[model samples]
Target: MRPLADRLAALLGPLAVVAAVSFVSSLGIGVMLPLMPLYAISLGASPVQLGLMTSAFSLMNTGGQLLAGVYMDRYGSLPFIRVGTALYAAGNALIATARDAVSLIAYRGFAGLGAGGNLIGSRVYIAQVAPPERMAMVNGVLASAASAGQVIGPAFGGTVVELFDLRAPFVIVAVTSGLAFFGLLTLPVPKRPAAATQRIGAPTSALNRSVVTLLVANLFLTSGFGGFITTYAPFATELRAWTMLEVGLIFSLIGAGSVVLGTPLGHLADRTGRRRVGVVSTIPVAFFGLAMVLDWPRPVLYVITFIAGGGLTAFTASWFALLNEASPEGRKGRTFGFVSALSNLGTVAGAMGASAVWQLFGLPFGLVLPSLSALLAGLTLLALAPGRP
Candidate 1:
C-alpha cells in the first residue's frame, strides 16, 4: 500500500499541472463556446448558417486532431500543447472582432484547431504518464478540472455580458487561454522516447475490431452531445424565455455534475466493471433531454441537468479508460487522434443536422436526437468492446 501510495503521488505531480492548465483553459472556452449560437443569432445568422458554423468548427477540430496525432509520437505532446493553446487564444481574440456570421464561422473554425490540438495533446500526455490501473481516475481528475472551469464559465459569461457586452467573454477566453499557454510552457516535460513499436510505419489506418467498436460507440455518443449542445441555448431562451443567466446556470448544472461526480464515477467504473458502468451512464444523460419535454419547474430542471451531467462524466471516464488501455505502445497519439477525428465528425453531423431539425420541426424534436444517439451508443457498447473488470 505504501509503494502504491508513492506511485500515485508521483503520477499526481504531472497530472496536477495538467489539471490546473485544463481548468484555466476550459474556464475561458466554456464561457465562449455555448454563447456562439447566441452570438451568431445576434449577427443575424439563420439556423442553417448556425449549423454551418458548428460543423465548420468541428470539422476543423477534426483536422487539427488528425494533424497533431500524426506527429505527436515523434515530437512529444508538450509542443502541441503550447502551440495549440496559443492558436486557440489567438482565435478567441479574432472571435471578438467578428462583424458577420461568415466571419464568425471562419474564426471559430480556426479556434477549433487550437481546441483540437490542446485536447489531443493533453490526452496523449495523460496516456503516457498514467498507469493502466489509474487511467480512469487520472482521466476523471483532468476532466473534472476542465468541468470545474465550465461550471463557473456559463454563469460568469452571463455576468460578464451583463457587466459589459457579449464581446467581453471572448476577450476573457483569449486572456485565460493565454494564461493556460504560459502555464503549460512551464511544465518540465520529459524527452520523447524512441518509437520502438512504430517501426511498422504509420499505418494507413488504426482500425481493428476493438477499436472500431469503441469508435462507433463514441461516434454515436458524441453525435448526441453535439445535437444537444447546438440547440441548447436557443431552445431555453426562445421556447422557455429563460434569460442568459438562467441558461448559463442550466449549462453550468451539467458542468457542476461533472465536476462533483466525475472522479467518483470513474472510480466506480474502475471498481465494478467498465462496460457496465459505461452503459448505465447513458441512462441519466439520455433522460435529461427527454425530461425537457415537460414544463418542469426550474429546480427540477436543474436537478435533472445535474444528474445528466454526472452520467456524462461517468461515460467519459469509463469509455476513455477503456480507450487508454486499448492504445498500443508507441502509437497512443495516432490512435487517440484517429478516434477523436472520427468521433468529432459525429459531432459535426449532430450539430448540423439537429440545427436543421429544430429549425424545421420545432425545438422539442431537438431533444429527441440526443436520446436516440445515447441509445445507439449504449447498444454499441453492449454488443462489442472489451468488458474488463
Candidate 2:
C-alpha cells in the first residue's frame, strides 16, 4: 500500500498547478500586508486615513465577492479568478507608484475587487472538487499552502524594505502576481458538480433562518478581525515600541502556525465534528484579542498569537466545510457569496470602527471592541448555527 504521505501527495497532485498559483498570489499579498499601515503613514495618512484605506479595500472586496458569487454559476469560476488576479497585480504595481494616501486608497479599492473575485472563485472550485466527507481536510491542505506563502511573505517584506525600500516590496508583489497569472493559465476550466446538474430544476437557496444566522455570525466575526489588522501595526510600532521587523516576525509567526497546524486541525475537526470544533476554536481568538488589550507580556503575546492562528484555521476549515455541505446544489456560489458579502462588510465596519475608537477613546478600547465582537460572534454561532445540539 502507498504510504500516507504518498497517498496524500497523489491526491493533491492534480491540484498542484492551481494550488501553486494560489500560493504565489497569496505570497505577493502577504508581502504587502505587514507594511501597509506604515506605508500609508509614510504617504502622510492620519490614523483615520489609514482606516479609510482599509475600508476602501473592504468595500470593494465585498462588492466584488458578492458580484462574483452571483455570476460564477453561470459564467464559471475561471474567468473571475483570472481577471481578479490580473487586477490585483495591477493594483500592487500602482501602489508602487503611489505619491499620496489618496492614490494609495484608490488603488487599494481596486485591489479589493480582485481579492473578492479570486476568493469566491477559488472557494467554489474547491467545494465542487472536495470529497463530501473530507471538505475540512481538503481545505486544510489549501490553507497550509496559502499560509506557507504568508509565513514567508511578511518576513520577506521586512528584509526587502530594509534592503531596498517599501516600494521594492510592492514591486516584487507585482512580479509574483504575473507568475501566478501564468500558472493559472495552465488550469483546465472547472465544471460544476454532477450533483448540480441533477438538481437543475431545484429552486435557488432561500435565506432561511440557519443561513441568515450564519451570515450574521460571520459578519460579527470578520468585523473584529478587520479592525485588528488595520489597527495592529500602528499600535505595535508607536505604542508597544516594537520595531517593524518585530511586527513582521509576528505576522510570520501567525502564518507559520497556520501552515503547521491547519491540516492537522482540519482532520481533527472532521473526526470530532466540524461544528463542535468550530465552536471551540473561537475561544483562543477571543482570548487573544482581550489579552492584547490587557497588555500581556510580549513572549506570552507571541504564544497567544500563534494559538490564535490555529484557532482561526480550525474555525475557517469547519465553517467552510459546513457552508459547502449545507448549500443547495447549483447555488453554492451564491451561498458562499452571501457569506463573503456579510463577512467583508463586517470587515469594513470593524476597520472603521476600531480606528474611530482608537482615535477617540484610546488603544485599550480599540482592543476591547474587537474582543467583544469576537465573543459575540461565537455566542451567535453557538446559539443559532446549523448543527446546534
lDDT to native, each model? 0.81, 0.78
Worst-scoring 10-residue span by lDDT in model 2: 196-205
TM values, all candidates: 0.84, 0.82
How many backbone overlaps does candidate 2 show? 0
lDDT of 1 by residue, 1-389 (tens): 78767868777777887887788667876686668899899998999999889777778888989989999978888888888889889999998999999999999899889888888999888777676576777888888998998778777888999999889999988887888788787676854545564435233345656668789989999899889878877777888888878876776788889999989988888877777888888887777777776777767878888987887888877778777666666677888888988887787688877888888998888877877888688668786544564
* Top lDDT prediction, candidate number: 1
- Looking at model 1, residue 30 earns an lDDT score of 69
Candidate 2: lDDT of 257? Answer: 74
- Candidate 2, residue 67: the lDDT equals 93
lDDT of 2: 0.78
